[model samples]
Target: MDSIKVMMDIYKEDRSMKFNIFVILILSLCASLFAGTADDPNLIGWWNFNDGGAKDWSQYGHHGVLRNGARVVYDTERGMVLHNPKAGYLDPNEGHSGHVYCGGERASIADPCTWADIPRSYTVLMWIKSQMWWTPPWPGSPNQFEKEWQAIFTKGTRGYGQLIITTVGTQGRIYFRARGLQPSTNDHINGNTFIDDGNWHHIAAVCEYDAVTGQTALHLYIDGYEEYNSPVIATGSLILCSDPVYIAGSYGGSTKDGEIYMDDVRLYNRALTESEILTAMDEPIPSDFTGDSKIDMDDFRVLAKDWMETDYTIASDTGGMVAHWDFAGAAGETTVPDLVGDNDAVIVGGGQLDGNGAAVLTGGPDGPYIDLGANLGNVISDLEYCTIFIDCVWDGNSTSWQRLFTVAQPGTTEFSTITYVSVNERWLRYYQRHNAHDEETNASNPTYVPEMKGQHQIAISITKDYGLYGCTIIYIDGVKAAFHTNLAPCSLDLLGQTSRNYIGRGPFERDPLDANTINIDNRFAGKINDVRIYGRRLSERDVKDIYEGVSRQLYFKLEAPGNLSDAESTNSKVVDFKDLAALVNKWLQQVPLLEDNLN
Candidate 1:
């Protein structure tokens, strides 16, 4: 009997076990139980790394969660998990000054690693918030790669994170190195830049088999909206062996090196569709009122509609849909200067545009106004008023400058003051340093102008350029400036004409041909956000109101809100993969139920 049982066991192992019994059991269970929600197809695998085991990751990597054949980096400080690399950083040899690859496990050292069998195309996503910039060598530090990797997005020296790609060769060879695959493909994002600090940001990179029509894409999402994208470019095979993906650092063969914190690293075998990518990048909550993936009026409508249906218990992402007098609405009332020949008015933040491009002073067919009507007579908004706040970056640069709107002094019989506001060349230039009158007369080139690069914030007010109805008042942020000006109001008034209104462009002056002749492309570089316009002149109270209002508006617009449950009641809802699947299943079930009932 024993021999017979052993023989039977061998037979069962050699030949496939009959499915009769197992199949019957599975069928019975299926028939008896209710169907559960469908499984997520795109969730390749999830790893908390809590289970310390060598799981099979041939499909993703050799060591399951640990790819690149690297070891874990355990930091006693803050309990951060680091990874080992094939090489480490050591002082450069032969007076190179640049550090050389030490090649081994070392304490408190950051190194680069490679990967194995790189796939042709894939998508990589991760969450990283870092303060590594404050440490070690600066950008051009030794023992690091010569050229800095391109950041998908970044905050600056203050500390930031990014998703990037690069080549292995010392010469600038572009390839997808950070996430997956290498060696042979036509699509790649070699060296990109995307960094930010003290903030959790989502970064994703997608590559397609067909580089042309289905060109590869790299996205950097800060907060939510797709902040940046690269030109459609083709890449090669993404397989890696010796070189593995690096975290808190980069896979620079030899270039920029730094540290950062990362969470939720993910990779998709198949190139996810753009729509799916959008779903993954959005505010995780839907503030995109337009459904076009942007925070515009349509989205506002959704929030407004939802809020009206609910009690004050529920507020939209922007708190009751960007109000009129408050951050949730618009600035309903503000102080306006009485119209003398050339009076100045102060505007605070949170002022809403009355018309398309309301506060913008544009040039060309529309004669002149701020901003070049980039959004079709769209007033370029530079400030959002809420409550009392301080703004020092105002110069002319998009980063730091102020914009003013003027009505032009009553037309002088000798030379119409109206001409100042009716000129064709409305342009942009960096306003000179504050309170500095030494170089105000030089219209051709001001000594203290704002630069185009770097991050900045500017104030929007009315300057003295346009004569008639010059400036009724000026709003700082969204607040009404306390001091008014016909001769001297907000501050710096050396350009001749007083009573300047800060709209969406540079200050106004008596010389129509000289002042107010600026260009948008030339000025207002980088990005613009939270635009508002008011009809009344801003007072000190108004300034405070606008500052707080604008701050709250911007805050809610960018943040995830403290009261999520209340937010969900309004338009600030977050629908994950399960929600999508449930919706689809519900629709599918309806037809079958209807058919059965009819029969």
Candidate 2:
């Protein structure tokens, strides 16, 4: 029967009135669903060290701060981990710092750093991989790396108890030591396996102490299994000192000359069983594939519908291009054509076409530089938003500024308005100045990776609304690392008086007033792959696709809910005969939900 006819029958037989209010019930799941909800209640401190930071994931926030070059860096294979690079810092507990400091301030009712001091029984666990080598025979101070037994975790600077590494280099094993019985005497335990072979090993030390009898039992676990046990019953309590805790490098101790990576530092209030320890290592399941409760056939149903459908798109926003320099030319050819615009650039000084579609520029003063003509002037003069991408390799000049490309006033002796980009082994500066109003952006990640090595994609985008609401974004490879706004209000103007642009040269140490001087130079020495200038700011998604390459990805979509199988009314009841009839009518039909990916 039709919905209208059913309504008429219901109106005629008005003896029974019904009201059914449908509600959506949502499930509140914690971020640690893979971690097992059973473990969180006992977890005093948990730091996964993913997403490039050491923020405590427990209900109690005991965030750790990075000090002395102790960086939270991302590796393509290892994800995010704490990287403590070699011992070059000045000693007496060192300089060129390499540690994550968890202060002793009581943040929660039972602070993770403080509770160990009042402990009954607990477990300290972490995962570490070493790139350390044996460079013993100390020079001046022991604060410099004199041994491979660098500390991983300790209560105070070598205070109370610690879980450290023993032996040297590739044959290193786990060691746990703490003060016991007397203030001077200490009790210790060691693991059986040598873990310094550049592989991540999960290590845990458990202390079971009986205060009544003053007896303490120490146990060590490696990769979810018990590897060592010591039945040393001591008279004194396990002394947890008053100083703050350090991860990766001990307070006033040594670290690997190479990177010693550590992650997922967790502290538990009680001794966890072998089974619970394994549960803690569970990988998180990505459940938001389609923004639904779980990933099922419904998620892929749209993908199977049509091959021509374009639901997913990762296209480059190359539509509003201002200037593009491919630097394609043969030897003795002075001109490099601007692919987007007709204005071609003239090569000055010693520059050669590498025959591989790239330009290899010679370094220092009197180096090679491509002088871009009026090609970008027309578009950039009226431009409010600008996005630029430079694909280049670093030639390693950390002492002075080395330019990637520069755009400034041509004939003016005094350097005022300019737009410049620089990349060296240690620094990256994306600067824009309009009438001396400067705006600059730097890479936000701990490791300045974009120009530290081989040919990589580095992008800087300036976005603006109608008002002064805008920011500059820095993208390394494809990830947005920084979104910065200039300290003073800025205007985006690349061509102030007349545009004079050059590749592989900077104006920082040039003539006293003029940045376009050839007299003194801070010219770049690297190979230039390509350079792009867009009139409009490119979106983060587009920058990602530009670097990763847009491919055919299936775009799955679904219609609004409550369509049911057949019952086609807003207030249709679930237990109705019409619903069953409608369900049977479309029993074997396929759903048209997903579309194919497009650029």
Candidate 2 local lDDT, 515-553, one digit each (tens) = 566434667777777788876555554566678765211
Which runs in model 1 stand beyond 4 Å of their true positions?
1-116, 132-195, 211-229, 235-241, 249-257, 281-501, 504-508, 511-564, 568-599
Give the C-alpha miss distance for residue 530 in model 2, angstroms: 1.0
**TM-scores, all models, native as reference:** 0.37, 0.39
Best by TM-score: 2
lDDT of 1 by residue, 410-499 (tens): 122111011111121222222222233211111111122233123222233333211221222323233222212233222122222322
- What are the per-model C-alpha RMSD values against the true structure? 18.2, 19.9
